[model samples]
Target: MTRASSQSDPFRLRAWIKVLAVGQLSYASAVAAADLAVPHPIAEGSNYTDWSGGYIGLQGSASGAYGDYAFSRTTVGGRAVPSFMSGDGTGRRDQGTTATTIVGGAFGGYNWQTGPWVYGVEADLSASNLKRPLPSTITGFGYEDADAFNIIRAKTDVFGSLRARLGYSFERYLVYGAFGLSGTNARFIGNYPDIDTGALNVAKHEVSFIGFNIGAGVQYAITESLALGLDYRYLDFGNSRRFSLGSVPGDAGGPVGTQANFNAHQLFLRLMWFPGGLRVPPDPAEIAPHDPDDGNSDRYSLHGQTTLIAQGTPGFRSPYVGDNSLIPHQARQTTTATIFLGLKVTDTTELYYNPEFSQGFGLSGTHGVAGFVNGEAQKAGAPYPRLRSNRYYIKQTINLGGETEDVPDGPNQVATRRDVNRITLLAGKFALGDFFDGNIYAHDPRVDFFNWSLWGSSAWDFPANLPGFTQGVYAEYNQAKFAVRAAATQVPKEQNSDVLDPRVFERAGLNAEFEGRYVLPWLDQSGKLRLGVFSNVGNVANNREIVTLTQLGIFDDINTAAVVTSKPRRKTGGYVNLEQALTPDLGLFARASLNDGRTTSLSFTDIDQSFSGGLSLKGTAWDRPGDTVGLGAAMNGLSPSHRAAFAAGYYGLLVGDGQLRYGTERAVETYYAINLTKFVTLTFDYQFVNNPNYNRDRGPAHFFASRLHADF
Candidate 1:
């Protein structure tokens, strides 16, 4: 988690201002005393000398921007219409203007100074929720009343940026220019009509964008160790367009049109602190030497931390089956406690272990263990694959899956499975450079966990399974303000019992995913906006084994035969997104994605093509003692068919569809957090999802949760 000053609430602003004021007054008083105590004149340094040489410093700044966005008619159906055409207009239009955003980021830099000139590169990244309102206007024939006028209002969410800087120092002041790529995720909200009928449509949109940033700033040193500065940046997100067609006829045309050009700008005031002097000698002997065993000696340190987490789900029991007996609703509560421990052995290596124990009123208690090792394989620069760090981990558990079964005239079925736990080995190299970095690694090669649930409960337990191995390799690269990542996963049939069951073995196959982003520079740091693209493809053997646990529960036996042979079903799709920083604490984002009918497997599938966008606001509202907070909200939409698929998956009704349909739900969530003290915080979160296709009678379900966190 990243911690920064808040930008949203007015109370927070006043509190921070007071703190700064007090600090300034204290500094002034100290300076006065120092002036009276010192009498010697300070020596002047050379005018041609530059104040640079791999210096490190901390900076704090205030940032803000404006984000403008409009929804296209084609993306969603056009504006809403009356049951009977009243003559307001044949075609409806759903259009909105852009909103404002605000956010701030901290940065540090290093420079090598030469006479009158300093050159090097500096990089910084920030996470912010900058949002803007997605204003939607409806213009139609019979939609005259404001209440009858169908309109959708929403905001955008989370966004970020990365940039590099170059500069020249003159005496006590330095002027610099920077250029780097950036990206963001935006949200769009609106209401349209059904393609067939002229009814109103309500939904939210989440989008992504890639763009670039450019800025200039000048810093003046108050002393050799402190500096104050100001900077300005411009950002341009080229043609971030979104298209959609609504469910209704009137809403289908112009209302579903497009968002054309997007852009923004930002300005900030910054202060920096450098603890040590500007320069350090290449050899330790060049300067006064300190005792090796002194308190300030540089040496490796070891530390550790542990956390306890508790979670529960009410109203529904998980459908998975495990080793434990059936868990009763309301009658039996499932509770678990876990311990996570870590050891920092060196600057580049650490080891960790996490163990968990769970107990239920009517079921057997169980225990689980997981361990991991993380370390740098070699020094900064080493040969290719040999230069990679390796990580090995293993997890073992004995538990039930899903919910318990209540059979009418048969013996109750309890989870009964035990096999060697899953083992995972990962190795990857970290890149080093001012402009680029890359990592490549291979993931676990075995089916690590079995997912199952019994009838009548909402608890999901993991069952130990030693199925055939499933492994994948992934690589990612970041260069010139752009990032790209690709991954491929493969599962062979001979590794498990399913492979021997010809019907299931054939279903094993390969899957891959690729994504990239490019930042636009027209917009400055404050006005961040970017463009992004992503693609995914998968090939599955049709003859793979198929098992319908739900059907077996209903009929007490396998009732269906395998239909497709594992010949590798091919699925592929792609998407484009645009994100903009609207204010110092808010952001606007939009995106359109389309997936072909091929990659619809367990983890790689989409119900249908989707276009979404929304706004989000994230910033600290208060910085005073015991008064810190952050807040955020978002909304989105899904086609009816897609919504149905999602509903089915949520209810555990579709066994073989995999995890694809779960991505189709239309939903929204709001979150807020408050700091009670420096180490303690409270958070509240709520989620609302509408899945009309599942459970038939329950239109949508609302979930609420709260958490208290303490950091030591």
Candidate 2:
């Protein structure tokens, strides 16, 4: 019998975002129309506002699931075939396991109220990382019966529910219970690897199920339009019908029937917004008495942004190409949508979580140019949209006695008053660049320049995973005119790998930076300077050693294996960044960086030395102050040993031409941005590169791109 495929398709993240966003806008529009047609006023002497409206919410959940798996004997010609046998031929027919994971999702509902009771109908969808892998129970099986020690792995990637809610209200709080019909998209895999013959076989079953779930929860109204809630749920997916594992074929087990049942317990926190509800104006006493002028006083903040970039190269000079060389003609586009959520836990402490969805790739799969073309593109680009909890962190501020400044709300930053002199501590998963190597005119690819070297110090080799983030702690001491910062973050298990090394103390990255603000004496305009240094310690290869080993025939090809299998080593680097406003509308910026090239490049590019500088001017002179233009140039080089490795045919992470005639890779980029609206902008960019991949044999190359960016 053929196995059943999952019912749900691999829907893109961008599509989901669009659907949710549109739903919200439509509800809000209806609410506006109702308000004009009818007035909703606070009932005289009433203590509580009515809870009757259309609402939407986002939630984070922690859940644990238990499952049991069973298998039946298989028959190809009406003869029973042994299945899931031990190494010694003892039959084992069942397996059991449990898994704990985190989940993120969105929900929507409409509530109806009569007196103190409320009822609602709701629906939700979520992304989950629920998985459990059973250990190999039948190892050491011979080549003849590779399926004997089949290992089972089960996981649920996505789930959703359509539910009804009943609740009772008491002043500002509500208690509720929910019952729902739910569905889960799950996969089960069987791995059969033969130690004797070194052959591997994998069988997979992708299945979806509709089940039942029950839950209870409580919610507190922070305002008439917003609420916070805690929810608990229990879901039961009944035993699945026996299905054949025909994807993996062998005489040991032709096609065994398999079945499983799953149950999960979830506890989640949700933040909800009522589009048809009115917000209660806060009492003046609730504001911080010391700084009433500070922007927003709300304890929580929400912001979002989306960016779409389309880049291409009509055609570039390419006499020959290697494994990692850039294709002469290619065009690609990338889309990213992010939600920034923050909560002020106390006067001096804050928590932040940024859930992001990304899809598409950069030109040439983000390779070819040493100073890559798109800074927004992740190294691990995906053809289909994928969601990641990119940044979740805690921040504590220690304010030293000093004058304070009013802060405006922005992405990941809550609006309030902050002391001019303060010490801040941040711990969690984030990017090192969040606190180091900052330049006013050249930082933030989403806001300014788009080239890798221009937006960042390319030679710093900051520790990060494929998405340019890592788990770490950062500290900053701020003064009126100067600041100092330091951080320690996790490095990847291997270069450009998504998995971080587990040995935190032994394999890590340490970084520090000092920044100063001053007025340019000659120009009478403000300027800033930032100097930073870093050291990364991990198991990595040496370029010189790899070259020598290849010469001695120990390795057939100069490949990534040398770096993948290595002893502990260190890579050190430093960078200097400067930005000065030459005039009211024009600013100049530059960066110089170098890294010790004894060890192979890890986490970043192959360039050991880099110098990048640029100029940015506003459109104020032409009366379109919101529009802007930028120009930048970068020069990248390799150390002597690194040059030799490439010349000897060693492939670097991003660029290698099989053979090398060394020259500095030079790139110049220019862009014009048109402000389409307060929250959206469209930009046209062009770049020229000489000696692509630092190979003199390769002629000059040109690239063109268009980008659409929006934020709120």
Candidate 3:
């Protein structure tokens, strides 16, 4: 192609331009028409929060539940006691009752997304303090108005769930259905004015059971890997199972609790995060299950305690009541060492063994004072060190259900979590005090009050050999606010010896205790009341019979009547102890006990009726937070038969004199303990006695002691 001259090319240019314009116009029209016919896909799909990933989330919910609970006395010998049997819903709360509570927990799950379909599994656990009030007026537990429990309270402690989710995704929103298993823990507590020893009898239980959970949820994506979800769920846990007569939930062959339907409903607002998200999930096998709930750490722990006490009395002597007299100017010392070994065999089983060594002497060999001063001091002893396998036992716990308590590692305790409502079975050797007649403020002499009368009921004479060791079996039914315990122990071969009888059926000790625990928030206080009854079948002399023989000049000593009479008789008694925490730094405790005084003195001191009270105060009030001061008093009285036998110049093992001018033995004791460190304590104690050993002729005297204790 050649161009002509400029003037001549103008005509040719115009012709070329016309052709180019027509071509451009036709192409523009085609592009405009095609744009109308087809448009670009929306960007909503790309912005959706990817569901194909694992996520951990926090969930909060409003929950309500309904159930039935029956409060009846636990059974003994396969039969319910008449006093405790509540056949008429006397202290029961029925179904159709509701309570509202808030719950929060962490949940983790992984989702698999295939096109519009999504599937996932999740697990969660939560805790709550939920309560409801019920109307109930129950009486006759004890023979006092204060013994009645008029108000009933129900509480829920914890819950958990494992769920599988299926959903349909619509771009940025999902609608899902959830199916899973769920469980809850709860209990019922009864209380009123008298509720003495209510700590043992309060209908407190921890019950744990499984149920089916079904729910639906809707979620909205907020980012590529985050979403907000709202869910509604229903749990059908079935009935709250009945506990055994002892309110034991899982005792073999125990009675099932009264049939009671139980269930819950909840609504949750949840925030979720899907890390490592994708639009489409990889192979199912490639998904790793993330579990973080089972890393509680094995609890291997140790504990030990040692106590040394040195006591002295200044020039105090007795003439008449030699058998029960405190000798003149005596100085005594006691040393106790114990090592506790605990093994957690399983989730619900524990084995504990305590090897204890004791070396000590009490004032006048621990005879004069009916209300013994030293709890660790035994009557019969070889001043040389005595080694006793004080506590060797296996405890198996079965949970029924309710709130869970994390049990820290300690002596005779396994480190784990457990339902509050449970049954505990123990067998082997242990102290009767370990299972019965426990007073929170006065129980442990190594730490708290140390007077024997303040430590235990003087008149009950709980069965034991020297050093308070016995072979026996015990069953405990526990709940949130109360507990019931029963035990069968072998009595000593002799009345007050340190040997278990080879024939258990011939000389046995059976005991039952009911306890109640209460927290008074208004007064910032907590209290425990315990009621226990104990019976011992052993060779014993009747004081009345011995006295009759002495009146006829037929008895040289009370022991002669025991040899002439038939085999030993059954001796029974009961005690009630109450301990209250007035404040975080102050406590009050009291105990009253009575026993048939017809029997001669046995394993414990001689007192037919005993009363004791005390107060303990921490030094926080005086800005000395580690110091504690305590003051206590005890009164011991003898039965008419016992007094008469003593009056006739007949001596017994302890507490009998050449001549008897019977008067109640009264003692007042005070102690101040200085805490030098977390594990060490030094205490100074003093006691004043009036009419020691019930003998009016003995001079009132003063006893003093210094105690040093170390524990870990």
Among all candidates shown, the one with the greatest lDDT: 2
After superposition, candidate 2 runs with Cα above 4 Å error:
1-297
As a whole number from 0 to 100, the lDDT of residue 524 in candidate 3 is: 71
Question: TM-score ranking from best to worst?
Answer: 2, 3, 1
Q: Indicate the worst ten consecutive residues by lDDT in candidate 1.
A: 368-377
Q: How much lDDT does each candidate structure score?
A: 0.32, 0.72, 0.66
Number of the candidate with higher TM-score, 1 or 3 = 3
The list of candidate 3 runs beyond 4 A from truth reads 1-299
Q: How would you encode candidate 1's per-residue C-alpha lDDT over 1-712 as one tens digit per residue?
A: 0111223455344323322322232233224322112122222444422445344333322112344443333342433332211111101112122222234455666667665566666655444434333333344433334443334443444434566667775445567888877666665555654434646665565556788878766655544455545455666666565544233235224434455344555444344555443321122233345332333232222111111111111232223321111111111112122233433233223343434322211101110000000011001111101111111122122222343222111111111222222111222211111011111111100000000100000010000011112233333442333444443333322211122112323332322222233444564423222222223222232111223332344422221222132233443444444445555445554444444332222231112343434444544444333432222222222334334323333211122112122333344444454443333334443444443112222224343333333222
Q: How close is candidate 1 to the true structure, as a TM-score?
A: 0.32
lDDT of 3 at 203: 50
lDDT of 2 by residue, 371-467 (tens): 9888887887654346899999999999997799876666887766789999999999998887888887888777678889899999988889888
Per-candidate TM-score against the hidden true structure: 0.32, 0.63, 0.58
